[model samples]
Target: MTHTENTRVAVNGYGVIGKRVAAAVAAQDDMTLAGVADVATDWRVAVARAKGYPLFGATLEHVRAMTEAGLDPAGSLDDLLGAADVVVDCTPKKVAAGNVERYRERGIKFIVQGGEKHAVTGHSFTAENNYDTALGRQSTRVVSCNTTSTVRTLSALKQAGLLKKARGVLIRRATDPWESHLGGIMNTLVPEADIPSHQGPDAQTVDPELDVVTMAVKAPETLSHLHYWTVQLTREASKDEVLGALRASSRIAFIRMADGLVALNSVKELMADLGRPHDNLYEVAVWEDMLTVQGDEAFYAYMVDNQAIVIPETIDAIRALTEIEADGATSIEKTNEALGITGRLVPEPVAA
Candidate 1:
């Protein structure tokens, strides 16, 4: 809480998300990068060492060598768990359930990656919406990239009382076969029909009253994921109102309102021009030409490079949970309220 007192933070599982989180934490004045936990000899461990971040949960000999080399290294993950005030679980979803319980037992607070299926009581955070839900909470989950983008845009519409029901279709590119163990090599445009992608459901978790439908397809390209969305509104809202609302939302960085047409490539170019290096979690690029509204039927479309959108939101969530002053909670809270989902409570079921 004081300048001299650093928020000791550890990142579990050093992958893309873990790497980004570490960098963000390092950049913060109120927090210190305590260490990273991953299997010994993993690329993440190597990266942590290279970045001068302490290595944890790695081989004892390797840790000692790194420590002797003038790097801070913890002998094992247990040391990190004991020393850190906050542990961010960036491990894959399949492994998160077990790890979350362990951190809970250790009496350490956590920020969980949203892809995991574990049941946690913490708030679901996105910078544009539900930041307060995470701020001051002992545990919080950063919603998946797709969910963050969907909810931020829709929450704005919902707040304006314009949204009635929402339906979405996603076309996602697979992580390069080398990047993922899942065999995506030579596989192009594989559709996941009838299976509900987690994003829609996660959005509903934030606002249960939201009726949502979602579909997905996976491509071989590892670049970005695209989403096509439709919303039925209570009344016919003008296109200007929709565009104006989107522009005003802080979580939304790049939005173009061009005579009711939105395009993905334009948004992508805009981000490039803006010098946004990471698009997955930090930025949500929107095309004005892709948006269409006619009568009560409104259609919206956009593409989000997952890595840019998710990473920044993840960083913001960590800062909020740790009560870091510079994380800009006020801006996040104000944007969330403007999006119409502020203080919207999840309903409790009645006994029959």
Candidate 2:
């Protein structure tokens, strides 16, 4: 169905993902930022107000507190929902789960971040993997950053008919950059006790047929999560063939160590140089030069921008749940173009 008017989108948190979702919704020609709801009266909420996004409190008490703090919320969370056709709940882990009933009661389609379990939504979303399933649905959980990256790259290969089974190792960021000062691991690498960390099973929520397992450890840094994948191909495939498969998805951007992008920080620096908002890298930054293919195995690595990778997917999810756009590919293209997602971080060199 074609939407004549913009989708009214309200963001329920003004934190990392919520703020980005608000900006993305405002950026879309087919959507409008109805308002933002949050309990905080600090700098984050201040920034949300400064951006001119209508502000609402998460509760009546929170609204009173905001007024006391001079933040002047327009109303309560209920008011925000009344103005929005859909709401993206980017509240911290477990918090969004509590808001599910509120959203359902309002009959507003809602989206929860990956921190919430699949049972909360009964459907997990990654635009490339399951956009159609989410269309006109009441709610969906956009999988975690690691799972989002995993699905984007692996689904590319699976769609290309090169994947048989896959195993991955994840190096996770100990904490978010903003919260690093509060507390985080130092001089330590904490391994996840479970062999297949939650991300693997979570990825399966989007595609149950995937034969995938993952192990992970928390790293000291807060920049991004790095993943090393080892995949058994359906048959012997050449390096060129594997690269071609990965290149098919616009959400997977090719980065190279040869161009001085030797580490995660370097890729983040490149994003800043490219003038991305908050230096966000929405695509899975895969090392094209490092990807290798053996007889029936393909080994590669990529970086997941935990803070930013899922922003585009959330935008597409808003489109899907609202039925603003019927075709998945069309919504994807619109989102990519609006967010400036190219498949490569740098332009390919012209041959002499």
Candidate 3:
């Protein structure tokens, strides 16, 4: 195939985020899937190859193994970078620091997932909050999924002139859905005794202007990470006003019990029914039925799918770094349209 002027994007790891990012790049009209690399024998290497991504091995040995598996990778990690404009490093947390150093040494453009510290790239990205700041960044860090939701909800409300401060509780899943080898706690666990969990400060990494404090507890469910938000608004708001704002926002998707998919399980069912890639709901699922307002104080409940919500942000980061789209809304809309992320994924609430 003849290459055009599209920005070439290589995915450095074929784990959850890497696979998703690679697919997203393939879907983008302005981007091309240069290649993807992963460690040896990950099964997903074949998945990448089946998806038509030029497979590269994370190590030389991985290359040989994948070649035996008939994926016939292009080369090793170095070769992947040599052929690409940008690398999206989606390796595990323990592997990220070393990868970050390599990207820096090679003078290659890269975007790291939220697992790493904000300093990993020195440009924490959440398109709704700081798209312009990340434009042309040599190293970009897409904030973690939890922080992504907090920042997105806050950014839209702040822009609507209806928010003051927010305090949230992150009901985190005990483990990633694909992590079946690791057993999760049967009882609820509070990993952080601190009044505000690290996510509050992490959200600040993306939106320092938005005042947010967060706490966390772990639930047994691996389906989704649920969050409860209590926000103080600058002025009184009605439920309709809040819903109107969210319905108008670019990245927010609302689902309610009236839609006949009240709980998280049924939500996943809906995504599966829609034939979503990997059954992923890429948007932060806000519960419209839970939006409550009382005398300038409002409460909201939402869920973030760990495997999915961050995909769009990573795509936006690529465009921002490549200077293809300077405006957040434009980049976000382009990415959303390319990925088929239109209006709310849930059906409209049945007449109550």
Candidate 4:
């Protein structure tokens, strides 16, 4: 459990987030992937095994099954946590409560994702928005991708004293392309009679004073979630000033028509072209052409790469919960460098 030079970290899920976290941990100079565990001995376990991560069963019963499946699980989930400096529970929403208790019982620092409520971790973490508040927390929940986008945008405006209040409609994707069964594939789906959905409240979990409202719906597409936001600014500012303020943060990337970026698919294509691990686009893709202002009303639309945005935040949450790196900026910079994160659309800049 000692974290001086290289902190040991374990991931307790082999699905989307867990696998990504494990890979991210291995990519870090200051952290090593201890092991990754899961209950199901499915293809994901096979993928984890193929990646050469020490595989473990989420429970003892799964150990025998996992071994029989040629996964060669090293031990149980508890064993992985016991031997690691920190563990991140990438388990599903309701599945995390028991794991959180196990983390507490083992006195192991841990990280959770946004799917769970705030009670699971007692602190909401958005690396761009609330890294300072996450310092020294025993457990941190890296806010959901949608919430991450919301807070990052508003927090930037708040820092520049431009945000008065904001409201937005989240045109969410049906699901990841792989999860074709989980959402309405051919139709737009709305929450059962809920206004503002859960995103506004979820963002509030990170910053209690944030004055934002949200309405959400799911479209048939699956690549990314698009957000149409309107910010009521306290001061009159030009479109350039607003974009400049948002572009000030490395976590947000600008894609304007001038850059030949016309749609969200182009951003995804760019992430793939960069050969990003998991094709992850850590930066929130802001549309420069979409940014407009009239008097105090500012409007813009951005696309959230749902699958990849939270990956770096999970890394930052690890640093915060474990105090492995006390300075949030340093940790974020290190993570970004390790993952080759950049606000620049091109990996290498062309000559002037």
* Best prediction by lDDT: 2
Report the lDDT tens digits of candidate 4 across residue range 1-352.
4556788899988887788888888999889899998998888789888989999998899999998888888999878988798888888877887778778888888888889888887889988777888877788888899999999988998888899999999988887877877754684565525887899999999889889999988788888899999999998999988988898778888887677677778878878887888778888888887789999889999989888889989998888877788788898899889888767765557689
For model 1, the superposed segments whose C-alpha errors exceed 4 Å read: 1-4, 40-44, 58-72, 121-123, 176-182, 185-187, 255-281, 325-328, 331-352
- Against the correct fold, how does model 3 do in TM-score? 0.95
Measured with C-alpha atoms, the lDDT of residue 287 in candidate 4 is 82
RMSD of each: 9.2, 1.6, 2.6, 1.7
Q: Give the higher-TM-score candidate: 3 or 4.
A: 4
Error of 1 at 176 (Å): 5.4
Q: Estimate each model's TM-score.
A: 0.80, 0.97, 0.95, 0.95
lDDT at residue 14 of model 3 (Cα atoms): 87
- Per-residue lDDT for 23 in model 3? 87
Q: Weakest 10 consecutive residues, lDDT, candidate 2?
A: 341-350
Residue 224 of model 2, lDDT score: 97
Worst 10-residue lDDT window for candidate 1 reads: 338-347
Positional deviation of residue 292's Cα in model 4 after best superposition, in angstroms = 0.5
lDDT of 4 at 257: 68
Give the alpha carbon lDDT tens digit for every residue of 200-289 in model 3: 999888777878899898888788899999999999889888778776677788888887767888889999998899898888889888
lDDT value, residue 306 of candidate 2: 97
Q: State the lDDT of candidate 2 residue by residue for 151-262, as single tens digits.
A: 9998999999999999999999999999999878999999999989999998899999899999999999999999999999999999999999989998998888889999
